[model samples]
Target: MGRGYRRVHLEPAGAQHICANRPGARPSFGQTGVESSAMSRIRLAASLVGLLLGAACVPPPGDALEERIAEDPTLLRIVDRGELRVGIPTEALGIGADPATPGREASLTTDVAGWIADALGVEPSFRFGTTAEILESIHGGDLDLAFPLMPMTEGAVRSTKRSYTAPYYVAHQRLLLAPDTTGIDDVGKVCLFGDARTQVPVENISPGLEGIRSNDGQGCARMAASGVVDAISAPDLLLYELEASLPGSRLLEPSYNTEGYGAVVQYGETGLAGFVDAVIARAIDDGRWNEAFEARIASLTELAAEPPDLTAEEAGALFPRGLPLE
Candidate 1:
């Protein structure tokens, strides 16, 4: 056992009772001396127990066991089952499922999951879920991995049981403006569509601008159309989808707030995470990731015509070392 760490063994219920033979026993008038002596011994034993408990060592935190579980069962289970169960986002555009393509089973998230599965020598089985549902399903053991290019923002979903691999892509938050509008200066207020990732950067970029929130992107676009809000803010890819929906809307130049997107796994899944990180790094280095992006992702949106800007220095700094931001 490691220093300051000890395993505590618990006795089974009814194995032994400390006071089994002394149920409600007390000093009787006829046997005061005997009862008092017994009581004194009991008090002394209790004091000893208190000392033992006070000096007892608590086991290390759960993360200390991560190395021990480095050979995690998650990857083995997937291999044994012959299917890698992955969770994909349902709301994110270009990456998630699309309505226009019926039974069209391929998107960025799926493609990436497929690549990971290919390495595992199994097929990828996808489950489409919203952000909250994805995190919940991952914790519930219903998903082996979640690949939505989920933004690792401070406001994003978090769990102690969850961990993220190095990011495969990085983007900056941007504003979508009306065709006639010049830039942020021409816009008084912006719609965030109730997403914290967008709201944080938008607010930080222009603290004076009034921020508006709505139920969804469509609702925010409606408000912008009516001149209720001057602009909408989102990631470049998502802003493109919004721009397509609202004709004459253009992406404002010079984006704000850098964010990296990565795959999510259950905590202590070091083996799976290591494999995923290696795969992503290899793909990005070999140009395969860019080709896939252009074919599957950029082809969908006009604004995302170019792949994300991921320099070697940026990749080394953002991923394989630590998360980009808190």
Candidate 2:
């Protein structure tokens, strides 16, 4: 095991680590001086203080185990089942599911799931769910894949009992300042949306200041437009949508914090995640991903009366018959 992975127990700064379990234990080391104890304590302190920040350097437990799991039956069960069960976001207008008005069979996430199912030569069965419900499905093993990318936070990955693929998309928080304002550094108060989800990130940008909470960006936009608040910490997309409403407000460049979006699979299921990533990578390389964005998302703003249909031509470009894996 790497030194970082060694288990640590908290002890006093100067107290002798009188370990009876040490393989190198000797009578002189403990009796004459505390050299062993001093060394032990130093390692412990470094581990403890570095626990949070240092953890990123430590590799995940699944890395090595995943290589061996290919021989494990659990890894091969998906192919045997003949069905790919997925949980999808039914309400995200452009990216997730199509709006009820058009009755189209596809959206970005759903179509992607369908594409995977088709590639696997299995029937695709979908369950509609909210974010919380979908996460629960992943944790409980009720889903093979969950649509609508989950953020790759520690809590998100651990709680869902799953690992994420490389980021397929990244949405971030941005600060919008009134046009009259000189600079972001000089701004004092910031209006924010959502209490639990956005509170920490808002605090991160403006340390030592508490922001007023609103239900959504529209609420914050009103405050910022009227000059009731100096700035708003909101999504760049939302700011763009509200641009006409707040004519004089200027959106700052480079989003402050990002919400990395990746697909969620059952814990230790790196093989499946890898396959999905390969499909996505091909989509990006061949222009399918960009096509999906334009056909679904970009069309949403035009206020179209009906939804557009999706084509498998782009997705099929990756794997028309089945995966290359035997």
Candidate 3:
């Protein structure tokens, strides 16, 4: 169950080249210097032209760009121009999922992405693919960030050129039990399912656990509905969604080992990383992130009960983290 989740930090090497030529000194590129005053003037003019062109092509200052994005951001530059693209696994255990509607996967990630976009003052554009595919895309310069609920591992850090932000949320593995399993009081013996060889108890919760045998969150939810497995052990938020979808299924009282989720950016993008970090910190401070979480959970709860329409405030509040323009 490598699942492309690993803890690795990619640090940038800084300021390697410096010019030694001082003002009023003759320009030299080795032992031989510009031979004639005429040649020197021509070279200076060429250098000025190159400098002007380079300056024109450089990206705007962070604050200026942020303001522009706030005015009217769209997905075009973020997606098509490759300025800021995000990658996530097509389906991962409590982390990523393909929703029937666009931008409606697991609520936590959706809210997180929304906050990040607001912080960047840009619209977010997502690329969904398998874990391997997403990692490949990142390496090939197709993605600027990745948010796959990946576990911190050495290999992941090295492969994706990622620098992870602080943990935003934590989840624990749990067992999803069958409706018929009456006497199953012990949390461990909830009759977990996957392939028999890959299926292991909650004690063995690791990325490798998926290698032994693993079913996705949706698959486990379906299994619980069909009574194939006594219960499924996974992240609580995912379990909550599953239980909401299936009336009879219930999450066990005690959860297993807790794992953390963090935001990751491509290596060398310190500016972008700082912006993301600031936005997440603001989200925590302003209570927007919690609002979004509660709202989504409320919606799920309401849907389980009678599918009532949610207010705009309730839906918007579900994403408290707004983009910071200053």
* Top candidate when judged by TM-score against the true structure: 1
Q: What is the C-alpha lDDT of each candidate?
A: 0.56, 0.50, 0.45
* TM-score for predicted model 1 compared with the true structure: 0.65
Which candidate model has the greater lDDT, 1 or 3? 1
Query: For residue 178, what is the lDDT in candidate 1?
Result: 57
**What TM-score, computed on C-alpha atoms, does each candidate reach?**
0.65, 0.53, 0.55
Evaluate residue 101 in candidate 1 and report its C-alpha lDDT on the 0 to 100 scale.
48
Error (Å) of candidate 2 at residue 159 is: 4.5
Ten-residue region with minimum lDDT total, candidate 2: 1-10
| TM-score of decoy 2 | 0.53
Cα lDDT tens digits, model 1, 1-326, are: 01111121211111111123432121112221233344443443333233222323111233122222224455545544556777776665656653334633456666667656544445566676676677677787778888654565432323356777766566667888855566678888888853463335455777677777776778778887888888988766556557767777777667776666777788667678777776565455445566667755664455443334443234334323323332
lDDT string, candidate 3, 1-326, tens digits: 22333321111011011112221111122211233344443343343233323423222233233332222223223322322466755553234645443644544454556556533323446666666577666667666776654443333333336565555555445555555555345323333432232123554643322221245566666665666555676555456656666776555655554444555665555455555655555555545555555555545432221111222123222223432211
Error of 2 at 301 (Å): 8.0
Steric clash count of candidate 1:
0
Clash pairs, candidate 1, are none
Error of 3 at 227 (Å): 3.4
